[model samples]
Structures are given as C-alpha cells and as structure tokens.
Target: MSLLQTLPSLPSDAAYDLVVIGAGGAGLSAALHAAIDGAKVLVVERTAHVGGTTAWSAGTTWIPCTRHAKGVADEDSLERAARYLDRVVGDHADAALRRAFLAHGAEAVERFEQHSDVHYRPYALHPDYESDVDGSTLRGRALEPLPFDGRQLGALFGLLRPPIPEFTVLGGMMVDRTDINHLLSMGRSWPSLRHAVKIVARHAHDRLRHPRGTRLVMGNALVARLLHSLAQRPRVTLLMDTQMREIHVSDGHPGPGRSIEAVTLESAGTSRRIAVRGGLALASGGINRDPVWRERHLPGIPMDWCPGAPGHTGQAQALALQIGARHGQGAASPTFWAPVSRRQRADGSTAVFPHFVMDRAKPGMLTVNQAGRRYLNESMSYHRYGLAMQAEQCRSEAGEPGAAAALPSWIVCDAAALKRHGLGMVRPGGGGLAPFIADGYLRHGATLADLAHQLGMDAATLEATVATHNRHAEAGHDPDFQRGVTAYQRNIGDATWPGRNPNLGALTAGPYYAVQVVPGDIGAAVGLQTDDQARVLDAQGMPIGGLYAVGNDAQSIMGGTYPGPGITIGPGMVFGFLAARDAWRRCRSA
Candidate 1:
C-alpha cells in the first residue's frame, strides 16, 4: 500500500519529533535515518512524487573509504580524499563540513545498509572528475545503487518518480552503463545478446502489468530502496502534495538561540499548523528556479534549461533566509552545471537531456562555438564543460568584436561518430534522424561546409577547424586541449576503437551532423550556511537550534567543484544522515 494511505493521521496537536521538507535523496535520507532511530517523523513533499533531481540522475555517489570500496581501493583513505578536495575545492567552502562528510560517509552507508533497504556497490572503473588533482584515484571512491525490483514496492512503486524519458529505452526500460554496453554489442557477443534479450523480454512483460519497467536502476532504484525502508518504519509519515508556507521559530528576532516552534503547511487547498518538537531538516533540492536567485546567480541561462524536478522552487530557502539564515559564502559557482540538449516530446513537454559522456568525447566528434572553433576539451567533465561555456559566453557578452559565444554551442560529429557514439538525444545506430531533423533538434549536412551553413556559421571557419582537428586526430593527440589525457576522459571514451586514440578520430566521413547544447543548472551549490553537524547557522556563524539543512538546501561540501562522480548526492546523503542524528540527539536532550 502507499505510505500515505497506511500512515496514521497526525495527533490533534499535530506534534512531531522531526519534520523533513522535500522528499529528494537528502530529505528521504534524513527522514529514513530519523525513523530508524524511533523518532516520529513527518516528511513534506510539495510534488506528488518523491526523488527530486536525484531521481533523474545517474545515481552515482562519490564516498571514499566505504565498506564497498574495501578490497577495491586499499590505498584509499580519508586523508587522500581530503587532499584531492583541498586541491580542487580549496577554501570555497567550510573545511569542517568536508571533514565531516569524509569521516562519516562510510558510517552513513553502513547504517542505511544495515538498518534500511538502501544498498550500494563500488564501481570498478568510475574515476574522479579531477584525476589531475593530487591524491585522486581512478576508482573505488564511487558507488552506484544496486538495481531494485520495483515489484517489491507494490503499490508504493507509484510514489517513486520516473527516470527521464531520454535516459530510457523501448518506451520506459531504464539502462545502466553496463546495460548500454551490452545492448550495443548484443549482435557481436553471445553473452551480450543473452543479457540484452533478457532485459528486453523482462521489460516487455512488465509493460503488461506496470506503467514502466519493474526493474529499476540508477536513481530510481536508490529512491525505491529508500521508500521501501521508510514504508517499514511505522514512525515515519510521508505527506505528498504538501507545501510548507511559513517557518515559525521561537522568537520574533533572528538569533543564535532561536529554535523551531512550528510550521504552517498547505495541502489540498487547506492550511494547517503543526508543532515541531525536535528539528526541521530543509532538503528542498535548491533555489535554481527562484526568479530572483536565478537572475542574481545564473544570469543569461533560461529557467527552462534546468532539468531538475520542479519541487525545488526555493520556497524553503526563502523562508529560511527570512529568519537570518544567510547563504553560505565562497562557492566557486552558485550552481552545478551540465551541457544539455532540448527537444519537444510528443507529449508537448520539452526533454532537457544532459550530455555527459555519451558522445562528445568519443572518436570522430568535436564541439565548436559559434565562430566554429573548438574552445575546450571535449573529454572534460560535464561540470567543467558547462563552466567553460559560461566563461566563453561571458567573454562574448563583453562585446569583443570577434569573440565567439559558447552559449548554444554545437556538437559536431561525423557519420561514424553519429552512429557509434550518438549525438545528444539522437540514439546510437543512426535509425531515427528524420524526426529530429524535421523538428529542428538535429541538423545534418552532406559536408562540413554544408553543416556549418545550416547552423548559421561561416563555412570556411568550420572547415578550417575540422581540418585542424583531423590533422591532430591522425597523430593521436590533441595538444590544443588534451581531450583524452586524463584517466577519467579515457575511461569514458570508446574502448573498442582500434584507432591510436579512443577519443580521437578523423572527422572526414560524409553526412556530418550537429546538435545545439546550452549550459544547464543541475543543482545548487550556494545554500543556507550550516555547521559541520548539519545545523543551520545564523549570520554570525552560530548554529540555530532545531534547524538543519541538507541536499541542495545546504551549501555543498564540495564548494561548487565537481571533484568526482556523485559529489552532490554523496555529501547530500551524508549530511542528511548527520542532520537526522543531530535532531534525534536534541530530542533526547529535551
């Protein structure tokens, strides 16, 4: 049964030991942690479904020194991870929070595995984004959620948010990194053929009974596990379609001694007041959609570019700010960014597909600015690529006569690359290009010159750029940007390619294609200041009693630097776990 139907109603006084706002990874983690500790917890979700942006993500978490990484990374330690963070994130955020995450990340993983339904396994090949940084490892720091059978969730399975349509295949079958590889090589290898056929058959069977595939993977699985654990906890109450209106503190003035007294919530067009006995954990994704916040921090980017769930309206952050909960300082960027391509779906909704590792870094592909010149390495992390776009756009906006803008940058690929690597929303194997071209989402040309003209760029410049790339590619090196020099870059490149460089190949084939990409804010980096224990802090750096923030609602421990896979989700879950324990401690003290 759905938790909403099974949960008992709140008492007449509407009192609870803890209240968690937002039902994303962090909020769910906080609520689950509290519930496992025997606290009466109430989880408020504005959206009908749980799992915020996390649900749409790849579901990788970068937690160093976890039990899952024991045999995989004997050299890994908190000190080594700290050094990498110091090199990449240095002074952009509180070091204490980083330390706290490093120290307790393993414990948090262990706790959830032992006491809840959540489970994870260390990735064998996932590498940190900043492999060039000191003390970085090629693997063992990243963990992915083990695929879960959504059938186990039964009716409650409907509560989990579905994966982005662009990320799925055959209507609604979710595929992980391994599945994609196996599916792509099914025709060549018998084992791969068996695996692909098995999954496809399973998904086909599921279509008859379930709305989507019952075999959940990635972020969907992570959320399903958390939801399953919460369902088993009788003390937990999950309220969907509930919006928090106001946060009532213990005083009229904002002070360090302030405590959460109650909160006003609106649900189904009715407003009600509820009492809080322990603490309030704010995990409402982030402020990415807030108009003022967007204008102030993410200028020049359209609000529609953000692929995160709509629940992150910043209402909770604004409410927290009203009580003097100032935003954390010194983040390298206000928001974590990714390059995304947009297409109009048949349902009239726009699909904002993030271009991470699927195409750009592969052989025979290249990214170019409006001037039709390569700006940054194509193999760089999505976060770094987005940052580069913003930098180039900023330079162009400064009115330099010939400065090229990176906004609306085009990723150009030859026919081989288009078929093997797939460009943006275009799937591999090159079967469905007509619809995308008709919709203006994909542009193709008989030659590089024709492609450039179609994209409204100077043909001569684009031809020259392609010639230069091909020259370097033939030599198996990209000296200009060093595309595949890093371990992380090479790992994502085509491993089966017989070329001199897996990430490089001559773009000389006919029928070149291009797709436009814009920088997208995947999550927030700047958020309410919080202490090491996840307590929200006042302007004076004093902890505000009974108030906590996690997920995107709290300043990221990475300081806006994407050091590795799952930086955001890893710290989010860790801090959420800490916030719940701290809240429970306060309850016992009271």
Candidate 2:
C-alpha cells in the first residue's frame, strides 16, 4: 500500500501539541520520541516518501560514547568526545550547543534503543576522520543502524522511502557494511557465495510481489525501523504529500515575540490551518535545492549535481525567517560537498553518481587540474575532496597560466583502476564499456601523452605528474600530500591489494581514462540559528519561542565541518530529540 493509503484523513480543524515539518530521520525521530513523551504529535512530509536525504545516506551516526560503543575495548567517553570537538571545530562551534550535543547525544541514542525497536551497532574498526586529533580512536565512535527485516513491516514496507539506487546492486537489493564484503568476494569464497546466492533468491522472490527489492538494509533499514516504531505510537500521526504553506504568528506579524501560533498547510490543493500549542520542529532537509541561496553562500558553484532529495529547498528556513529567525553563518563552507560524475542511463535519463567511496582511495587513480598537475591527497573523505577542489581552483586563480582550466577538474585513472574500482556507475570488470566511451561519458587513450592531448591537458606536465606519483607509489610513500598515511585513509583503501601501501598503487597500466569532475555539494550547512535547546534564535541571540531547527535545516553544530560519517543525521537526531522533549515540557506546563 502507498504511504497515503496507510495515513488517516486529516480532520477539518485538527491540532497537535507538536508539529514536525519534514519526515526524514530527524523529523521522524522527533515525532516518535515526542509521542513517547505523551505529547500528541503530527509529522508533515512534503513528499510522499517518509525518509528524505537520510534515506540516501549510509545510515552511520558519528555519535561518541553511546551504549553501543561503551562495550568496545577502547571505549570512548564524553570527556574525550568534548576534546575532539573543541580541537576540530575551534571557535566555529557554539560552546553551549557543543556541550549540549555531547551531554544528550548519548542519552538520546540510549532512550530510543530502550523505548523503540530501532537499534544501532558500533563499528569496532572505524576511525574518526581526524585520527590524530585528541580523543580520536580507531573504533567505537561510529554507530551504524542495525539491519532491519522489511518483512516485519509487511505491506507497509512499500511506504518506507528507498535508498539511492546507485548504492544497491542486483537490481535494488540493499546491502550493509558486511554485506558489501560478502558480495564482493562471492566467486572465491564459499561463505560469500552462499550469501550471494541467498540474496539473489530473496530478490527473485521479492520481484514477484514488489516493484523493487524488499530486502531493505542500510539507510532504508534505518527509516523502516523508525517508521515501524512510529506506527506503534498511538498519539502520533503522519501525513504525506502535505505542504506547510505558511507560518502564522500569534500577533499576526513577525519579530519573535512568542508569536509562533499555527501553520497553513495545503494538501491535495486544499489549504487548511492547524493550530499548534507546543512548537514546530523544522527538519525540512536543507537549502541545497535552492540555487539562489546556494549562489549567495556558496559562490561559483552550481547546485545541479547535489544528492539531496527534491523537497529540501530551504522551506523550513524560509518559514522560520518569517518570524525573524536569523540565518546562522558558519565558519566552514556553507555546504558539505562531494565529487559527482554524470552518465546517461540506458533509459535515456541522466544518472548522477556521487563518488563517496571506493574510487579515490583505490590505487592507480588520481585527480588533476587542467594543467594535468596533481592536487590533494586522493584518499580522504569526499567532503575533504570537495574542499580541496575549491581550494585548488582558488590557488590556480592566484597563479598565472593555470587559471584558465582549473575551475572544472578531472579525475584521471589507469586501466587498472577503472577495471578494479570502476569510475562513477561504470562497474568494474564489466565487458561493455564501448558505449560509455562513444557517448563521451568516458574519455580514453592508448597512452598517457595521447590521453592528455585528448583531455586538453598539458602532455609534459601530465607525464611528469605520473612519473613523480609512480616513483613514490613504487616505494609505498606519497611525498606530495602523504596519501594513505592516516588510519582513516588506509581503512577506505583496497585491502585486496597485497602491497605495503593500500592507497598508493601506481597508474602504469595500458590505456588511461579521464572523467570530468565538478565541485558538487551533498547538502547545505548554513541555516537557521538556534540556541542550545534547539529553539530558533533571532539576530540578538535570543531564543524564538515555539521555533526549533534540527538537522541540516539549522547551522551544523559541527561548525560546517564533516567530522565523520553520519555527522549530519547523528546530531540531527539528537537535537530532534531535544527539541521534542523541550516541547513536551512546555506543553505539559501549559
């Protein structure tokens, strides 16, 4: 059944103690926890799907010192977590918000595990992005959503939002951290072969009854578990394809004078006003979809290649701004970024793939500017790669002769890397790559000089760059940027390679390939200013009653830095809990 079919019809004048706008991980979590606190809650989703961009994510939360991590041998404590935050964020992080996140983030995860069926599992080997930072550990800081059985939800499984199709294999069969390894080693290992066979059989069974594979995992699992938990809450209601048109103030004007009253909503072309007693939680994804705002904050970049969902166009930020909510300026870039490559699918539609992992960290691949000179440590996270791209662009502009072609970079790799790691959506070891080359989706040449000429890059410069890289790669060292030196880099690097340096394989194979790479953001970072309690604040730094912002909709408490995996959703979920509980307290007192 569709999500709308499962929803109850809205009453003519229905009201709720708390109204949550947007039904992603953060909004849904707020609604679920608020209902558990005995407050009547309603979730208004702009799209028919429940999960927003969170559904497109990896479902890992970079929350430190949770119950899931406490049992690990090298356990992380709140004190250490505080130290990490202080060093990573510096003056950018809000002192109060930082303290609050460390204090309540663990409790928030614990509360949900105790009261809801949704659960998280700690990664024993995953290290923080900045492994050298104080309080950083090699494990026990990142928590990923445990795999969920979609059969538990039954027909409601269709109501759960799906993950990015690019993340899946075998026609939409979702996989988790362990599942990927099992699938990758299918032919050589008996246990992997069995796992692959079981997955295929299950997907075949699901195809008979569903349009897409029903064996959900990863982000889909996270959303499904939350949906199931929310369904069990008697006081919670979810309405899909509902738009929050406008927000009304108590005095019929703006200025944050305790004026949050109600919201005007339009569903199926019919507008209705619903009163609110507690407050509104803004979790409408973020501003990645708004080009005007993107230009203002993140200049010289296009918003066409983002991985964010369709509905995150700064709706929540705009609504809050109507009542004098200040736009919080971040010390870091106004957005989180990733390098993206676009390809036309078989259906004639364009498919944009985010190079999140499995590409840059692999040996034999590197990125270069128009001059064919290498820049950056190619083994870092996608967020860092994006920043490096922009910084290179800026540096090129300052230098002479290289400024002409540095705005749009290119990812160059050898035949080995292309066959092993794959470029964008062109799978590794796949036979049919002629069409991709013919269509200009991929550029190839028989030799390095020929490839450089074809790509409009300097031939001598390209040759020198490869020679320098090969000299270092042969010895398992990267002198330029020290690639693969950090634990985080090596973890993402290829383990199958029997070499001293996992991320430093020389690109010396036959034919070389190059693909266009542009600066692309995964989501917006700058957003509404809020206090420690999550209440939206004004220009004067005063809390605006009845207004709270969480997730990407608010200025990231990480101070615009991507600390680790799930940084976006983890704090979003925590603050969502804080916002809902605060609303419960205010409503109960009333």
Candidate 3:
C-alpha cells in the first residue's frame, strides 16, 4: 500500500490554504490579501489582541508614488524615491530588494484602500527626514487613517490597545498636523469656535454611552478602523492567545528537500496542528524584547522603548532558524534605542519617554549623568538617540570596571524652563508632583550648584555649561551646539522665544529640577534576510520554499538609518503585499 494509506489521516479541521503567524499590521495585511484572493487563511497571534505595535504607532504610512499626490502642490517621482533609498541605505541593501519595494509599494497601498475598509488620506504636512535628497517631497507621499469610530467595536474595544492618552484622540477625528494647526488657528477665529462647539456636543453624546471618552485621531483611530473592517470579513478569523511552537515540515525525495506542512501551536492549554496547503507567511515581529537576546547582543544599554506586545518574542525567528533560514550581516539583530523622559505612572510604574517628552511645546529637558554632562542631542531621531544612549552606557561601563554604573540620567532644567516650556510635570488626578519627585527621577534644588551636588556632578562644570548656554540664549545664538540646526528639534523647541533659533534658551532660574533619562526603543528592526520578492534565504543564499518574512522581523530594507517618518510601517505594508502576491503566484504555478 502507499505511505498515505498506512499513515493515520490528520484531522479534517486542521488544514488551511494559508497559515499566517502573527496578527499585527503586516500579518493582518497579508492574510487579508490572500483571503480576498480565494485562499483559506489562518492568522495566529501570541497576544490576546490583534493590533500589535501598529496600534501604538503614529499611524502615518509613508508611500512614494501614491495617487494621493495627484492634486497636491508638491511633485514626487518613483525614481527620486529609489535614489533616496540608494543614497541612505548605500551598499548595505540588496538592489533587487529596493527595486521590488519601490515598484509594488504604491500599487499595494492603493489596492488595500480599494479592497478594504482602510481609508488612506494624504498627509500633506509630513516631511521626509532628508528633504535635501532628490525625490524627497515635504508632503504628498505619506498617508494617514481617517478618523474611525471605536464604538463600532463595542465589546471588542478592550481587545484593542488604546492610544497613548497623553496625546489627544477623538472618535471620528481624522486629522494630520496641518489639521491640528488649523484647529488651533481656528480657536482664535470664529470658524474655529463654531467647530469647537460642534466637537463638544459630539463628545458629550459619546461620554454618556462609552467608558472611554470619544474623539479619536492618530494611531488609535487607524487600528480601530482596520479591526472593524477585518471583523466584518467572513474569510478572516482572528485567533488570539494562540502561540506557535514549531514548524511541521514534510519530507520530500531522498535528498534534504523538505516543505513546511503546518504549524503546531498551544492554545487554551491544548496542542493543535494547523496545516498549510497554499503557503506560510511569518510576520511575527522582531527579537528586541527578549532580555536574553538583548543581553547577549546589546550588553550595556537598558532595554526600555519597545512598543511591541510582550508576546512578540522570537518564536517565528526560531522556527525560521530551525528550517535553516539565514540571517543578514552587520549586526545579527538591530538595536532599538530612544530617549525617554523619566515619569512615574499613577500606579507607581515607570513612565516611558517620547510619549511624554518629545514635544516642542512641552520639552522634557536635557538628560545628563552623575558628572552633570549632557550625553546626547535630545532632538536626534529615535534610532540615533538610542545609539547615543548606548554609547553613554558603554562609556560608563568602561569607566567603572566592575561596579554597576547607574543607567538613569538626569533631566536638568529650571523653573523658568518649566514656565517657558510645558514640562508635562503634573501628572493627572491631582497628584502633588510626588510621582516624579519621590523616586529621585525628578530632583529639584533652589540653585544650580545645589542641583549638581544632589546629582553627584562636578558643580563647576555643570554651572559653566548652564552659564554658557544662558549667554547664547541672550545673544540669540548657540555657540556650543547648534540646537536649532534641524527642523525636528525646532519643531519641539520653545516657540515663544524671540530669537531666530527658538530651541536655544537659557535655563537660568531658581528651583531647578532634574529628571532621570533612560534608554527606550520603538521596536527591533532586525530579522531574517530576504530578496526583492520578500523570500527568506537560507545559509547558502538560496530561497526557502513556503517561507516569507516582513515588517520588523525582516532585515530592514533601509539599513540602519531611518530615512523618513513612518519608514518602518511603509515598507512593512509594501513587502507584506509582495510576500502574499509572490506566495499566491508560487502556489498557482505549482
């Protein structure tokens, strides 16, 4: 008899046309595409929720050559986008991979809007990090979600991760920076007052019904909208609290040929195997959150800024490795680092940074060590900011030898600084600044000398740095460091200042305060290497069949540098679409 006849038949319910591991933005997009194409799809997410980090993100997706740019004043071309990528990523990226992303990104973005409930509105205000680069337009390519109603999710609202409340969000509130500015400008105008009245009326109506007050904008609006769309699709089924343990491979011929047949997972305390007939797509995110991995790779720095779900470990990466999937060069994994303001939560938990600090209207101030020296430019991009924090950690380790050097750095500022820039010092719920001051996270003193002494810094040096900075503020020039050199820094700088360079201001006032700064990361950007088609490559540089990776799990196509805002999410959606399309083609050909 045949081998099939001898073997016991597998359960009828265990099989599917496509098995997608992880249900974040990338996985969700891939599954939606494949399912719409008539393939039976299964999405397994380790977390109980489906939104992943995308829920916590800014929700602005940067896409070049998009239709949203048609009537826009600024003009951009695909060739220019390609050149910018080439210049920024240089020799690190595969040329074929870059070409594939550029060719398909626009098509994928447009197609998703047409087929799904996702609304793609042109973010005319967003800018590329390097506008000097050719093809880089100030606005046009970026797209954001239109304001979505979370009430539609009903009981599923809790399953959706809420946006950072510190930043405003309102249901049915779809807006970009320009929209917000217009709102603020209108507050000063008759039209704005009327708009505000309308908003208040809507909010009052929402408050009586929902626990979380209504107006929605930014990342929260995007996730709620997408999940609402996915919920309506009969082909898409969300399996939460399900973790894949291993890849079930089918042995072929005599040689070492094998194919991924299914994924064995543990859910609800029981083991089950989900077989894949069409293909398997891995969008399970990166390995940044694994303390063991971070300790092994990035030894000195503190791991603070991960926006991914706690379940976003390297299960998918381990599975890929088991199947002989090869990783890329130049740091086996990418280091995630960001400057975080040290704040205490209402329940005495440590508050993360950027969410609390990176605002120009409300600056978190400069973070210094025990030596009273500023370690990094507070306004550097998140990627570079993390590198700077790591460098500081390295220097501390090198200096101390065996003793554990402190990881927390002090955010030095004065009362006048607080008055000029909203420091976000007051926590909600009428707490007496005790949350920040009690833990030594925020140190206050009447004089600079006292503050330096309290922070264990060289009083003379600290005083000199402040004095020098103050002199520059009076002169309307920054001699030591050009604080206002970049638009990002200036954007968050004190706008009320009369000087041309608003970011530079003298922190010369009594009752100085110092808050500790720590290392935080947005998410890991390192994973398995792939070519233009988003195909996973093995140790010998050959494609692994029935396997693909995208988003943060795939080695970044932009290399180490962040080229623009929403760079991570933009490429993620593009490659996700590419992976699904390629897999569909392969399955059809077979």
Candidate 4:
C-alpha cells in the first residue's frame, strides 16, 4: 500500500504535543521517543518515503561506552572518549554540547533498545578514524544496526526509502561490508559460498512479491526498526507528502517571550493550520538542497554532487530563523564530504556512488590530480580525502604549482586491483568493462602514457609519478604522504593482501584504469545553533522555547570534523532522543 493509503485524514485543527519535521533517522527517532514517553506526536515528511539520506548510508553509530561495547573494550570510558573529542574537536563546537552527548548517549541507546525495536551490536575491529589521537581505541565504540527482516513491516516496507541500487546486488539485495566480503570469497570458502547462496536465494524469493529484497541491512534496517517501533505507538501520527508552510511563534518578534505556537502545513494542495502544544523538532536532512543556504555556505559545489535525499531543503531552518533561530559557527568546514564518482544507469538515472573504502585506499590503487601528480595519502578517511580534493581544487584555482587542474581528480589502478577491489559502479573481477568504457565512466589504457592521454594529463608527468610511486611501493613504504601508517588506514586497505603494507603496491600491471572523482557533500555540518538539551538557540545563545533541532538540522556537535564512523547519524539520533525527552518534560510541566 502507498503511504497515503496507510495514513488516515487528520483534521485541520488537530493538536499534538510535538510535531517533528522531516522523517529521517533523527525525526523518526524523535517521534518514536516522544510517543513512547506518552506525548501525542505527529511526524511530517516532505517525501512519500521515510528515512532520508540515512537510508543511503552504512548505519554505523559511534557511541563510546555503551553496553554493546562493554566486553569488547573494557578500557573504553566516557572520560577517555571526551578526551579524544577534546583533542580532535577542540573549540570548534560547544564543549557543553559534546559533554552532554557523551553523558547521555549511552542512556539514549539503552532507552531505544529496551523500549523500542532498535538494537545495536559493537563492531569488533572498527577503529576511530584518528587512530593516533589520544584515547583512541581499535574497537568497541562503533555500533552497527542489526539486520532487519523487512517482512516484519509487511506492506509498509514499501514506505521505506529503498537503498541506492548501486549499493545493492542480485538486482535489489542489500548487502553490508560483511556480505561483500562473503560474496568476494565465495569462490574459495565453503562458509562464504553458503552465505552467498542463502542471501541470493532469499532475494530470489523476495522478488516474487516485493519491489526489492526484504532482508534489510545497514541504514535501511535502522529506519525499518524505528518505523516498526513508531507504528506500535498509538499516539503517534505519521504524515507523508506533507510540507510545513509556515511557523508562528508566541510573539511577533524574536525575544524571551517567543515560542513555537502553531504551524501551517500543506498536503495534497490543501493548507491547514495546526496548533502545537510542546515543541517542533527540525530533522530535515540539511541545507544541501536549499539554494540560498547552499550558495551562502557551500559556494561553488554543484547540487548534483550532493548525495543526500531531497527532503532537506533548509525549509525548517528558514522557518526557525523567522523566529530568531541562528546558525552555529566555528566549525572546521560547513559540510561533511566524500569523494564520489558518477555513472549513468540503464534506467536513465545517474548513480552518484560514494568512494568510501572500496578502492581508493587499497593496494595497487592511487589518486592523482589532473596534473598527473599525487596529492594526498590515499588511505585516509573518505571525509579527509574529500577535504584534500577541495584543498587541491582551491590550490589549482589560486594558481598553485602543478595544481592547475585538480577539481575532478582521478583514481588510477592496475587491472589486478580493478579486478580485486573494483572501481566506482563497476563490480569486482572486472566483468563488465565494455559498458563502463562506452559510457565514458571508466577510462582505460594499455600503459601509463596511454592512460594519461586518455585522461588529458601530461604523459611524461604521469609516467614520472607512477615510477616514483612504484619505487616506494616496491619497498613497501609511502614516503611522500605516509599512506596506511595508521590502524584506521590499514583497516580500510586490503587486509588479505600479501604486500608488506596493505596500502602500498606497484601499479605495474596493465591495462590500467582510472575513474573520475569529485568532492561530494554527503551531509551538512553547519546548521541551527542549539543548546545541550537540543533546543534551538538565538544569536545571544539563549534557547528558543518550544523549538528543537537534531540531525543535520542542528549544528553538528563534532564541529564539522568526522571523528569516526556514523558520526553524523550517531549524534543525530542521540540528540533526537534528547530533544523528544526534553519536549515531553516541558509538556508535562504545562
């Protein structure tokens, strides 16, 4: 059934204790938490589907010291995590907010696991991105959502925003890092073969009656669990295809007297004014979709480069600003980024695939600027790699030496690496190279000089870069940028590789291949300023009553720095939980 069919008509004058705008992970979490807390809640989603960009992500949550990480890393503690954050984040964000997240994050996770369908398990080997940072650990901080049986939602599964087709396999079967490993090793290992056969068979069965595979993992599982939990709450109403047209405050001006009073919502071309009793939680994906915010904050980036969902139009921020909500400052960057490659699919849609850990850092692979020169340590986190791209682009624009053309960098790799790790949209084993080449997505050449010509780079410079890299790679070292020295970097590299350094290998084999990568903002970091309790704040740092912001809608507590996996989703969920509980407390006092 469609989302509209599942939803009953709500009266124009209907009142709710809390109205959450945007149904991403944070919004859904807020609604679920509030409803569970005995407050009448209404969730408004701009699109027909729930789960914003979170559905497109890997769904790892980085919360230190949770019960899930208890036995895995007994040394982990709130104090240590705080110290790590203090060193990495510094004064980029409010210290109080960071402290609050650390203090209450475990409580929030405990609440959801006990009171709702949400569950998490710690990753045994997931390390903090800055492995060298003080108090960093090799495991137990990152949590992965348990795979969900979408069949539990039955027909409502259709309402969940489908995972990116490029991220799935066997047509529509969703797979995670573990699944990919199993699929890759199925040819040699009985256990892997069994796993692959079981998943493939399940997907085959699912296709008979469903639009996509029903065994959900990663972000889809997290959203599905939240949806199921919300469905069980009778006091919660979910409205899709709903737009918040306006927000009215208690007073006409921005001041201590100001508080969210009512909101105008439009659905199916009909506008209705509904009173709000407690607060409005803004969980819109971010300002990436809003032209004004995009231009003001992320000046030169194209909208097509952003991989987030379309629901984050900065509409909620604009509405809050009308009553004095101000954006936060002092962040390292305005957005979180990932280096992404684009490919045109047969369905006429462009697949903007994020090059996170698949190929860039693996042995026998390297990224270079248009000048055919290496610029950064290829084994760094995707966020830092993207920042490096931006830095290179800025240098090129500023006429820096040998950096004149660096915007759309290239990831060059040999046939051996391409067959093993794959290049953007192209699956491993190099099975279908013809289509990718014909579509101008993957560029290939018989040699370094030939590839340089194909990529419009200087032939001699390309050959020199490769020769120098090979000399170091043969010695199992990266002198220029120190690639793969850290635990985090090695973790992303090919651990099965026999090379002394998992990230270092000579790109000697031909035919060599290259894919174009551009900096893509995966999510926004600069957003509405809020206090520790998740209440939106004004220019004076005073809380705006009856208003809250979570997810990308709120200023990231990490100060725009990517600390570890699931930094975005983790804080979004923790603050969403906090916002709902705070609103409920306010409602009870009223």
lDDT tens digits, residue span 1-590, model 2: 12232123667677889999998988988888897787888889988788898887888887888877766834568888888888888777687898898889889998899999779888868878887788777788788888877888876676678777767777788877577777778878999999989988998898888777877777788888899888787788777788888988777877636657889888787787888889899999988888789778778876666767779999778878877898887567788888888777778766667887768778888888888988888888788898998888887777755444556777888998898888876777745688889988788888999999988987999989999988888999998899999998998888888767999888887699988877678877788988888899988888887888988888889887877888888888899999999888879887
Write down the worst ten-residue block by lDDT for model 2: 1-10
Please estimate how well model 3 matches the true structure, expressed as its whole-model Cα lDDT: 0.67
Question: What are the clash counts of all predictions, listed in order?
Answer: 0, 0, 14, 0
State the C-alpha lDDT per candidate: 0.90, 0.82, 0.67, 0.90
Q: Rank by lDDT, descending? A: 1, 4, 2, 3
Candidate 1 off by > 4 Å: 5-9, 399-402
Where in model 3 is the C-alpha error above 4 Å?
1-11, 71-73, 131-135, 165-204, 252-257, 304-307, 331-333, 342-349, 355-357, 360-364, 395-406, 424-434, 494-497
Better of 2 and 3 by TM-score: 2
Among residues 3 or more apart in sequence or in different chains, the pairs in candidate 4 whose N, CA or C atoms overlap within 3 Å are none
Q: So what's the TM-score on candidate 3?
A: 0.87
Report the error of model 3 at residue 175, Å: 9.9
Q: How well does candidate 4 match the true structure in TM-score terms?
A: 0.98
Please identify which of the two predictions, 1 or 3, would achieve the higher TM-score against the true structure.
Answer: 1
Tens-place lDDT digits, model 3, residues 22-116: 77777877877776576666777887676677776777787888888778724578888888878867776676777888898878877778887
